[model samples]
Target: MTETMDRNFIWDFIEDDLANNPGMKVHTRFPPEPNGYLHIGHCKALCVDFGTARKFGGVCNLRMDDTNPAKEDTEYVDAIMEDIHWLGFNWDDRFFYGSDYFEKDYELAVGLIKKGLAYVCELSAEQFRDPQYCGDLTHPAVSPWRDRPIAESLDLFERMKNGEFPEGKYTLRAKIDLASGNFCMRDPVIYRIKYVEHHRQGTKWCIFPMYDFAHPIQDALENITHSLCSLEYEIHRPLYNWVRDNVDLPGNPVGFPRQIEFARLNITYTVLSKRFLRGLVEGGVVDGWDDPRMPTLCGLRRRGYTASSILDFIGRTGVAKSDSLVDIRQLEACLRDELNATAPRRIAVQKPIKVIVDNYPADKTEYFEVSNNPQDSEAGTRKVAFTRELWIDEDDFAEVPPPKFFRMKPEGEVRLMGAYIVKCNEVIKNTDGSVKEIHCTADLETGNGMPADGRKIKGTIHWLSAAHCEDVTLHLYNNLTTLENPSAKPDDKDYTDFINPESKIVVEHAKVEPPLKDAKVGEQFQFVRTGYFCKDTKYPNTFNRIVTLKDSFK
Candidate 1:
């Protein structure tokens, strides 16, 4: 069982329900539409759904809400399952598809017609939205076919199911109050005629049931005790109850499920809309849905985010009734905190510049032992080669000393990490006036120790033996958009306009210690002062910088 100290208003309600109704099983379901890949925004709901069930020692079913097949695909179904499993949750044998209840949805619609609770409306979708038919707050909506006889409505609905009418020619609307204060209660269309073939059901269904009509029925049939969903569906709760009150469902031991809504996750500088993400994939703006820069779960996984770190983040965020924009840095902090202690240390020189230990014996090589993870005592140590020729990051040296520069400089002393105190005595320049190499004399007596003269070395820089290192490609990722809230951009500007141009920077031929040569795909490492990196899952000899060491979130 998963242990959590986190508590929210939802838990209070569930506790009350359990108390009032003894022997109540806290069964829940996570029903995702198979239209697009899951994103970080969905992680919140996933945790609440599966986490709540686990907390109560109950079961959670995984259902694909494939009611709308226009944009749905089997690919999304497989991806959804994979993502859920990767997040360390499972539904076991209780997997289902919304289309599995299509025939039952049709039967329920016919029953609603016979009970004078629904009717076959002739108004086109566009015409129904016209002010004359969709009344304002002061006026009630008008429908010419609201009074159509049940016999004729049933025949038309049946024919509509059999493809007798063209798309949008007929619709099955719940016969709710047209004058209700809530707009959703005003004769909402529960079923619409669509000629598109379903991904799972194929051509067997042409007239499809709307989400509001199909969802509650599926919950009741599955005996779901609580239908936890996002706050956007709060207004639709009345309609959800209306269906359960009217439909004479089969033997459901749990009666009807209660629908609960909570705030959805919104992160600054990120867009969670699948429609927008799909546009980016189709327009070639990103490599694909799993691009490291995208916010999709698969993208984050490929970029080196761990499931435990993500879950810890969700737990800290807590559940709220009102929506709020979370700083993306908080998410980064969680990853950084976990990786700092768990990831083994490795040396990687980005934008390398050669360094020669002029005083060291050129024919000899020594091994220096360095802690794999300073934060983890049991992680132990690994030996790194120390040779006469070394590679260090170009930034570690400055040709002209800046104010209070502490790293490598002409005639300045610095510590080569895990090795020795070295003093730069001369700089070798290329024809272009760039520093081609730095020549330093190592105080061999101070190997990983202070100098004998008690001189302070203010800077320590990581380096790899030039002859013992391997070249690798590095991918550094930043925020996808420059704007803090791309969804709130000005009316005239598209969200895509704010896409950060430098979101991903690729560095080719970066040098790493030989130990990394055998690093397997998806292995994470702390690149000693560079950042945390993970071996690329898609490309060979490539590592993606997961996040820098700095913590910006307060």
Candidate 2:
């Protein structure tokens, strides 16, 4: 809610409303359906709802749109609340569920029937959508039951609620224009019979109100001043207003709530559809909803993403009236920026090779002082143990040097980061013709200082005391989908076919500095020359790579 020079269109509308109606409070609501975990896509609407309230010094309510109990559960509700709190927003005492207003919803539907604005239709779902009923551009839809008596329709609706008829047997449809250009107004179904048990209301109700009908009623009943939603709902705005104008709710003292639609968030190389993400979890394509490779908020949290960084990314993306695909690298850059300035530095050798300092005493062990975070002055320093035997990353050495390779080579000198300068004298190979150990001689005079011989060492590599380090597991992650826009793939091919097989790479045994042994879950650190990583919350001694050190975003 920080004041920015460039105000988005939503803010402009709110400002105009306030100007026209003085003393009116700005109120909003975030109604997320509790069927699956929230992903980055939801975060945009979330910020717009809560952030607008904060800016206007008003109130924002959190509501669960759990009208459809087919897949609703209390577990997803709890996770939704947790995710909102993690983003540093709260609903205070203004929390509600769509099912809580079931009695009112039923009364309003009955009121519509009595006023001849609604009627009970006995057409099957498929039959209702057939060419005869669902008219094309040239002809209007025709329903035989459209002229049914109001009294007869009321009787049928009551019976439908009483569970006398099975689901899809009858639906209460609003008597709107059948030839309306917008199909949402073409006698939309206001209520349907669903025999499923509600997560909260239990078996008290057999028939539930559809979202299109229930959402406006809930907003009006809760006195929501503005109902901000995604762009897809823009076409349904007329119906939203119709429900508000017809319903006579005592709580709706502010007249009709304004409906505003904004563009949805779409990022390349990632899928944000809750249904698709659910498939990934249920089909065992991924570990679970919180898999580090998934785009769910919990997954990003496990991947070492901070709430501030996410908010920053959302802020940078800004509010738009039209949808556009943003590069995923922009999100990664925000995370990398925050982590670079906050995460402490640590040494980890994923592929380790033994380095034996021949000139140094076999039993000798020295300490080197290194900065925990060079970017932060108050971060201070930590002591790293330097022993005669050490473990260095295998990539830092080459027996037969490649072109422009400045790292440890035969008879070449390189500095051990924060330690002494060492020269590789010989390479020891195992019976299988692979590097087993490296023999080197250290310049004792260059301990924690440059050599007096005026020699410039172009290569510097991080090392860990072989005896003082701990073995841990490391997980490196890439894009979940190989294609930039998996959703736009050929219609014949499924989105799952584009799943990146190499999205997650695991290293069973990696050496880490002693300080990392006490690192708590959720704590992030920079792995020196490697990448940023965080301790896995669900696994022991496991770290997930957040992002590489190099920034690929401009």
Error of 1 at 511 (Å): 0.3
Compose the digit string of candidate 2's lDDT tens values, residues 51-92. 999898989999999999999999999999999999888999
TM-score of 1: 0.97
* Alpha carbon lDDT of each predicted model: 0.91, 0.91
Residue 289: error of model 1 in Å? 1.8
Report per-prediction Cα RMSD to one decimal: 1.5, 1.4
Q: TM-score for all predictions?
A: 0.97, 0.98
Candidate 1: stretches off by over 4 Å: 1-5, 250-255
- For 226-303, candidate 1 gives per-residue lDDT tens digits of 999999999999999999878888665443589999999989899898998999999999999999889999999999
Report residue 364 deviation for candidate 2 (angstroms). 0.3
